[model samples]
Target: MEKYGVEVQEKKQVKEEGLQELPGTHENIVLRFAPNPSGPLHIGHSRAAVPNAEYVKRHNGKLILRIEDTDPKRVYEDAYEMIPEDLKWLGINPDEIVYQSDRFDIYYDHARQLIEKGAAYMCTCDGAAFKELKDNCKACPCRDNSVEKNLELWDKFDTMDAGEAVLRVKTDINHKNPAIRDWVAMRLVDETHPRLGNKYRIYPMMNFSVSVDDHLMGMTHVLRGKDHLANSEKQKYLYDHMGWDLPEFIHYGRLKMEDIALSTSKALEGIENGTYSGWDDPRLGTLRAVARRGIDPRTIYNLITEIGVKMADSAISWKKIYGLNRNLLEPIANRYFFVEDPQLIEVKNYEGGKVIVERPLHADHMDRGNRLLPFDGSAYLAKSDIADGVFRLMDAVNVDIKGDEITYNSTSFEDARDLKARIIQWVPAEDNVNVTIVMDDASLKTGLGEAALSDLNVGDIVQFERVGFARLDEIKDNELVFYYAHK
Candidate 1:
């Protein structure tokens, strides 16, 4: 085998056994969403996961969820379970689930084969020296080491200190991409893996292990970010050497959202430092955070599919995303009145007894039914919901209020809509229910909601008439807690 030169592949090499193309049938495809168990799935992950899961479904194929838990240092105990839960919440179910830590023997077997074939060697070069060589496109002294010596060093993973040895694949040292030159296939990690503990010190580097797994797992197509194109090329060397057919590669561009803290490191760091509540903290960009802020999973699916599998990076604004969701929510979300920063005003001509008021759950969706509110002598209104003049109390009779003076007017919905009256939301004092609205910014707004809100269960999405759409989080005692989604 010539060092730093492409090897001639066997002429009659065919696809692996069991992966043979069927007669009069299509190639059975398999897709995957491989997320390392380091953190919960973020919106950026959704961009990757949605397409993989969607393609498998459309093609009537399989979607394997391979947890890239090979990096012992980055793995977290909670994330192993949390990642799957987040995916389940988003309605993405994997056909097969695998953990890399469980497949160490498989990776080790493949690594040994490469070493025996003189296709890979163990290099003892330090980080600084390797950087210097990489900078100058110079091959390190260990690049010419004998196969027997490299195999001896590779077998010493149990005794060698971490970073004492690295198993490097044979590649062009003068390759245009410095990062691609003789890529490390395996390295000794000192850290105790969350799942594997210190049971294994020899860890297979990403491309080496991924190539092995994809071939053995029968992955037919790989749909991933364009950033992984270089990785795909590097992995191809392993496939061609092992006489495995290359999987169909469909690389899409990155999807970045404006104002979102997309870095998993920063988000996880914030959580650990008490800067964020958890993975679901509204300040973070994780899918749990988006759901906690009341964005629907169905909406997320539609958002990603709309972008499709593009070649160019897609930059999106949160406003556009919420605007689309608002349209989807309006028809289904029940309407209620909630008065925050509540100001009380006395209805001057009101009788002592309460006046019954019927408010429709949805003005256009009559099938949603109505809720009844009672007005005695006073009404609660949001300070921002009213002007200094007469306005129609939404779904009820017209009310004239200047400063604190409040007087009743006509009971015509036609007049309110026709005159383009300023529609204000109000909760009669008798029908007020203490409520807390959690805004997307993580602030809590205390308000008084219509008592009818008591019928709403947790997870129900409701609109606060003139306010915004909010998802019910909880109800304790007489108070209703909601997560304000968007208008």
Candidate 2:
């Protein structure tokens, strides 16, 4: 799998330094995972969270959970709620949760301070006026307004509804980067914010809000997607102008691809158009979807670990993700027998007898011991295995299949060789065993009562012995209901 871009950058930095750790311990070091509440976090967002939380944890520092809800037009209620929940589910519990919406007053105060310092001014130039000027954006005629007049305009801005006017910080319009040319610090937006409601209109842009919040939150490090590196430089300028302590800024490459869309807007459109189930749809790669599909949090952590944090952008494969998940789950998952598309087999002419088959939970690890399976004369085995001429039952016992008849001589478990043929999973049909096994397609319904199955509960994970890993999807009236293992 291709490594994440951020991982590449980190490697280069480390090679140059010949060390990973900073010189001395910065005991007060603080990091943050600031997710915008415009949409539920996707797999790409999860990638960002892993390293950030790890850095804080390794340093025994604080990880602040901040919500950047400045984009009032795009923010959603459910999206906001999901931000923290997803982080918590991933085993990343931030020390504090802060919302930019709640800090409007603080942002406004800073905007006023900039005005008073002659560093910012109100720009009434409408969108049309900006487009007409194009590359040579003419400085607003009010750019040189007196401090007294600017304060009144700032006060009016503090009280006006959103979208009314914008406060732009003074910067050279001829600067090489267009983004550095007097970007808006605050804008008047009257739209109803999903989280804050109609409380106020003035909202800070990302560059302004992040810089202010990082400072106020006492953050010592700011690690984010490299797409925001330019914005980081802009923010550094603000910190310099204000004479405030500047945090270490590290930008990693963004998680993106050619065919795969990463924009929340595109995701929302897919849901609205009925092209996807919802934000949690497995196909979308959102955190909820990945969780629902049985991808463990540790798998996500390991995935990012292998990729490392760097500046070169890359695309990760779902296969690599599953491989990690399988490794993580191998030790804990209980083994059971499940044969999808089962074919009933009868040992003709033999008296009905029962055999206690002991199958190890993990084939490679004997310390896990074996699980007991009550096998009767009649059992359901995979139809494909029966057609393949031979079937190896657990414990290295081979059952020769000729036409519809399967003949096997009883053999001592100790003397049996490891099953050379595929070990076909079986469920005792004569013992009234009820199992709700899931296949690649539809879920199966066995006649046995659902209560008898062990290690199968809603959300409980299990490996169907020789079949595959699965999660209990539903359990009702003592029946096992499982979903196909995602890993």
Clashing pairs in 1: none
Candidate 2 vs. true structure, TM-score: 0.84
lDDT of 1 at 230: 91
Off by over 4 Å in 2: 1-25, 131-134, 158-164, 256-279, 363-370, 395-398, 403-422, 432-452
Q: Please, what are the lDDT tens digits per residue for candidate 1 over residues 308-373?
A: 777689987888779878988888898888999998877676554566888788889887787998
Model 2's alpha-carbon lDDT is 0.71
Error of 1 at 457 (Å): 0.8
Cα displacement (Å) at residue 112, model 2: 0.8
Report RMSD (Å) for each prediction in the order shown: 8.0, 6.2
Candidate that scores best on TM-score: 1
Q: Candidate 2: deviation at residue 243, Å?
A: 2.2
Give per-residue CA lDDT, model 2, range 1-487, as digits (tens): 2578778877776431211342334586788998888888877887678777877777799998888889877787787778888898889999988888889889888988888888888877775675355357557676889888888888777566555578887767676777677778888777888877888877789899899889988888787888887788778778876879888877777665323564778878989999766776545667776676577888877677556567788788766777878887777776666665567787554443677777676677889677766666667776655764545666534666788888764443443334345456676665434556544233353433212355446787777654567776666664566656554
